[model samples]
Target: MSNSGHPKDHGRRRGLMLVLSSPSGAGKTTLSKMLLDEFSDVKLSVSATTREPRPNEVNGKDYFFKTQDEFRAMIDRREFLEWAHVFDKYYGTPKADTEARLEDGQDVLFDVDWQGADALHDQMPNDVVSVFILPPSIAALEERLKNRPGSSPDMVARRMEDAKREIMHWRRYDYVIVNDSLDVAYQRLKRILLVERLKRLRQLDLEDLVRGLLGEA
Candidate 1:
């Protein structure tokens, strides 16, 4: 959201804030991991959380673990770009770190729910590119949820119910892809990112470069 420290290069541009959202069992997490693994320029947005860390969850890597009072103080100081209360814990994207990465020309990928995506886009409209993933059909979605490891029948049913509600928000996204095949969907997702990187508005020095070419400067 913050672009104050951007470099002055015609070829280099500001980083993207790519938001991927989907219901459970829709393959959003899989795609997010793929992007991170394949792209060096893309970094997952690490959030600050007011929750006890689970085993092997390192602070400042998995999350910026904070005490409740510290988290509340951050909220009061407007340190977060987007913050949410979920399941009695505070989670937020710290503005400074995100802005620093963007200024360094590194795209930040956000693997968030629709609500989180909406909050991000609302706060930073120009930098956000939102995508919603979908299952091929309701039956397919059900099957995926059922087959998930350690998922009980009740858990699957609850997730299925949540999926229906989540799917309703797909129209709010800039793009939607039905993840019928993981490979095909990944290709499409990659293409979207590549094309978005080439957007004219994002290229900060094009106007000057073009003028120099035409001898108009």
Candidate 2:
């Protein structure tokens, strides 16, 4: 409920899962890369996937590659914060991995869909700051998808349909930025992160900070 300023944040702050969800061509990936490159303490949410690594994909850095049986065992153990089966492969965020980062005061960026965001919010409502990026219009999103090198006409059509579906979940997010201009959108997203980091509840050292303030009085 502490919304305005960092009055009690002279000490360590707990980190959050800053989720950025968008449809195929809506620029979430680009924003994620920019944030990771510019912010020293922010990292990507490297998911555990059952799929084999492609060329140049390194284990642990690119993904935690696991066999199907191993992944199922993890599911039974409840090691994932959120997980889903997509395109015949299981991908999930390990609870230990992301929670470790959060405890160490490093934000983890999640580039997931709306369903994944919902699952994350349900698990850790206070520690999740969700953002949804939107294309200006479906026509614009379709054009962007069509221009992408690997997208076929059918692929673009299917992505457009999916975009419409994804856009419907905008109201569920804490913030919504239209990816009309990359620079503007990034500025807004960056500001949101800066503000959320200072929320009083996230400042884990607030008790010590308050005691120090009283001592000064």
Q: Write the per-residue lDDT of candidate 2 for residues 1-217, one digit (tens) a residue.
A: 2223323346798998999999999999999888877777788998999998999999999999999999999999999989999999999999999999999998999998999999999988999999999998877888889899988988888888888888888999999999999999998998899999999998887888678899952
The RMSD (Cα, Å) of candidate 1 is 4.8
Candidate lDDT (C-alpha), each: 0.90, 0.90
For model 1, the superposed segments whose C-alpha errors exceed 4 Å read: 1-10
Q: 134 in model 2: Cα distance from truth in Å?
A: 0.9
Query: Estimated TM-score per prediction?
Result: 0.92, 0.92
Off by over 4 Å in 2: 1-9, 215-217
How much is the lDDT of residue 151 in candidate 1? 94
Model 2, residue 124: distance off in Å is: 1.0
